[model samples]
Target chain A: MPTFNKYVQIEDKPSMVPAGLEKAITAAAAKDTRIIAVLEDMGFPGMLWFKKNCPERMIECGIAEQNAAVMAAGLAAEGFIPIINSFLFADVGRAYNQIRQSILVDRFNVKFIGREGAWGEPGISHNTIEGIGSTRPLPNLVILNPADAVEAEKAAEAMLQYVGPVLLRQESSPPPIKIFSDDLPFDIGKAFSLKEGRDATIIATGYMLTEAVRALDILEKDGLNVGLLDMCTIKPLDDKAIIKAAEKTGAIVTAENGTVIGGLGDGVAAVLAENLPTPIVKIGIEDEFSQSGKMSPKDELKEHFGLRPEDIAVSVKECISKKEKLRKKRK
Target chain B: MAHHEKLVKDLEKKANQIRRDCFEIFGSTQMGHAGGTMSIIELITALYFHHMKFDPKNVDWPERDRLVLSKAHCCEAIYAALVELGVYPRKTLGTYYCFGSPFQGHADRWCTPGIDYSGGSLGQGLSFAIGMALAEKMKSVVKDVNIGQGGFLQRYVVRFDPLYRSYCILGDGECHEGMIWEAAMFAAKYKLDNLIAIIDYNKFSLDGPTNEIMNVEPLVEKWKSFGWWVTEVDGHDIRQILDALELASKLYGDYRPKCIIAHTIKGHGIPAWEREHIHLGRGAVIMKGIEEGRKKYADV
Candidate 1:
């Protein structure tokens, strides 16, 4: 197994994301009076904390995601930094045109906290895997999907500090184990390399990073040395880090909790095809809707979608063999 | 005539001039949103020239009242008014709809000055206007009060009065969008009296008559049900529009949003244009309308 770096401090206990988001936003709003909370009908876990602490800053838009989207645009125009929170399908999907025409066209300063991923009981309606692909093409919008609690808090703080449009995805997997140390040095458009290997490298984003951490162990047991990279900022993908990983390993496997169509896999594939031409395999949900599944000892959805550590280990071996075949042909 | 009468007479002449200018700009492009633009001449003229608070030189002054044109398709009227107020050069009117022109087909705040919100999509402006109005209520102007005792200075915070209002103009056909009612309920729930919305009830949308396409009849009851202080006026009459605006502004402290349904006809001013429900007049037909408009409104 590759040795974990200083940035990797995987704790034993798992923590919920809503608590982390609440802490970060509460700290940011305490100092900046311009920050306001604009929420839809389905409130987050600690939404009442905001209403209790800063009642004047809370705005209830009530089931009308379209109205809330345009209303936040208006509030942003008047210098109030409004943060809208909802499910990805409701906030970004139901109001896609409003976000594009009203918000992105003028590039309003609005923050969206969209929660969507797989392996939950809400099923396809709430847990859509298309948010990443759908929002990728919109101009002037930065998309961030943090891997764990520490990274989530840092991404939220960074999103608040930046003065433009940003969408932070809180993936809906069983809560990820606390993975990063407190002082991880997070930036908007950079990636963090967790381990280095010669055989192959696995680039992971969102909750899939935790699975990749486990996949590294599985590969090591099978006598293959693999590297791990945490890709938090999906947009403005860190070309240097991706190219370095490609150059070192010559084979790549991309992992995400969503679709492979336009998610992190496509982004990495395009980067490799244009720059390095490395052997790559994308690991994500196929072209179909997600259904209800359990996350117990078996983890039914992960098993069904082939997103377990065993699945990732299989893909890694396949990628490495592709690289070995290419070398043999050249010789 | 009395002084008030003279003021009304002057505003009427200004309205006539604004109508003629809209026709001339439409003729320059040989095509434009002639019906809705013509219908809102008196309402737009009353707001920019006679009612709203703005500086032609400093367009982004924080305290200045804002105009959120939700039905941005009829941007020619706003452009003509901006030119009249010296916000843009008169020559800019000739470049309407051309590339790199500030007079975009829609009312974009980034491209054009004197525009508060960028709008091309319908049913979004009222919500945007409500946002500005809510923000204005929350905005504060800070003043430092010095309490000096033994050469020691202390500061105190005091509340400032409301400085500006947000005026939004929407089209009757645009009411078909469900987002309009969503905004309507929101403004009422917040009791945003600082937001004023005026509807240009010109009886037509893009396809055909609004009633035949999708009837929005019983419109007044709809606004009243949505909790707005509603009123009706002749959109073409300068006195009526001015009086309604003045009344709406006076009700600011009453804590209720206002909606004025100004009844109007498609292609209102020129007889040749008014005979047909022409949403976008073009070429020979618009030229004929311009020829007729010059005879009626040029000298005045």
Candidate 2:
């Protein structure tokens, strides 16, 4: 087993995604009185934190995600920024129409923090990997998926600072690697190039970014030059960075901890197919329902869905060979 | 006549004019929500012309009261009222649903001036109203402060009226949405008394009778059970709607949101369509001929 050298040793605990979100939101509420935290029944430790710190700014809308969504729009209409926290299935899946019609149509400044991906042994019902794909089609909605807790905090701040609607997907199980610094720069539609090379480029998002970095390290040991790009923003995709990567590498592989169908893989593929026609490979769940078991759901699901870093490295190698074959055929 | 009576008479005239304009606009479009729009003409007129506090000149004024037409398919009526209120030009009504017209088929807050909330999808308005009401509650309060000057202290209880009232008009058919009840329970739980939800119980949905489509009977009891102050009114009677609104305004301090179930026929004004299974956009082609003749004769 290859060691993840960049990963820092930290106490294993529940994800700091919610904790970072609560801290950032509470701090923002202190500065901006217009900020309000709207919660469905799903918000846990974060809800408790908000209630304790900024009780006046917190709105518990019960388990009704639909009402929670529309109420956030209404509050936004009245010059208030309402942040909704719920599971991905409840917020993005159930309230998809509400977000599309009420929020996005009017460009309401409502922020949604959707807890996504498998964790805590939750069944397939809670293990939602399609939220990014589902919400990506909505016009006027900014989709942000942070790779780690630090990025999650910055993402929370960025969502609040920006106007209009934003859907920030936070992983329930935080990545073991701390890829970003405490004060790392985070913009709404900008992609972060973690490493740069010319042979092949790996574009990844959310939990899969950490895995992509690990795969890059593995490929480097084999004398294969590879680049790693963290595509945090899914919608209004970083087309500039993607075009740059496509032109430089001519071989692209997208790795995501989501279904390969409509997630980051499809997004990057569309950009490359349109702009550069690069040979591409996608690494993610190949259209299958995730299973829960006694082992850590995150590890089991990642292994079961072929989201391991080794798997991504293999796909990248295969894509590079395809690019070589295409070059020879053209010659 | 007394000032209140004169006001009522003026509002009644405005209601009739709105109904006429609504019919004319829907007829011109040959595709508009006529049945539900006609049913709630008097109630909406009472709110916009008589009860609600709003400034057409400053439509985005923070202190202005808001109206959420939850049953937004019936946007022709709101468009007529908005036109009459001078928010938009009277000629804008002629461009309803025309290609590239800002007057969309449904009530869009962003596209139309003076519209507080967009409501095409049903059962969303009540929640939006609850949110506005909650914001009002947060912003509006009486606070006591002490000021010290020259070693002398002065205390004053500075009280301000609530920011603004939020009125949401929902259709009986819209109540079938589970989110409506969710909003109902949320508003009651938060004691959002400043929010008033008026259900236009016209008794007909898109398919057929509401009872046959999906029974939403015991509406009053349902709202009451959800902790709202329930009141029933003849939706066609401007005076009854005004009275119910007045009662609702008084009940604000009781810490209960108000629900006024306005019983009305599907098409209250148009005789041929009234009491029939008149869903939205139906009978518009027939009404178009009548409207053209009336306009030609200056009979509005």
Every candidate's CA RMSD: 5.3, 5.3
Candidate 2 docking quality: incorrect, acceptable, medium or high:
acceptable
Per-candidate interface DockQ score: 0.36, 0.38
Q: What is the TM-score of each candidate against the true structure?
A: 0.94, 0.92
**Candidate 1's TM-score:** 0.94
The prediction achieving the highest DockQ against the true structure is 2
**Model 1 chain A worst lDDT run, 10 consecutive residues:** A43-52
Taking the tens digit of each residue's C-alpha lDDT, what string does model 2 give over A102-195?
8899999999888777543777887777887787888898999887777788888999999999998887543446666676788889998877
Q: Calculate model 1's interface RMSD in Å.
A: 10.5
* Model 2 alpha-carbon drift over 4 Å, by segment: A1-15, A43-46, A118-120, A294-298, B1-4, B141-161, B282-285, B288-300
lDDT of 1 by residue, B209-250 (tens): 987899998999999998899999999988888889988888
Best by TM-score: 1
Tens digit of per-residue lDDT, candidate 2, span B60-155: 888888899999888888889888998888788888888777688888888887888787888888888888887786664343222222111122
TM-score of chain B of each: 0.91, 0.88
Compute the lDDT for candidate 2: 0.79
Candidate 1: tens digits of C-alpha lDDT, residues A105-216: 8889999988899879878797789889899989999999998888988999999999889998888898787889989888999999999988999999999998898888
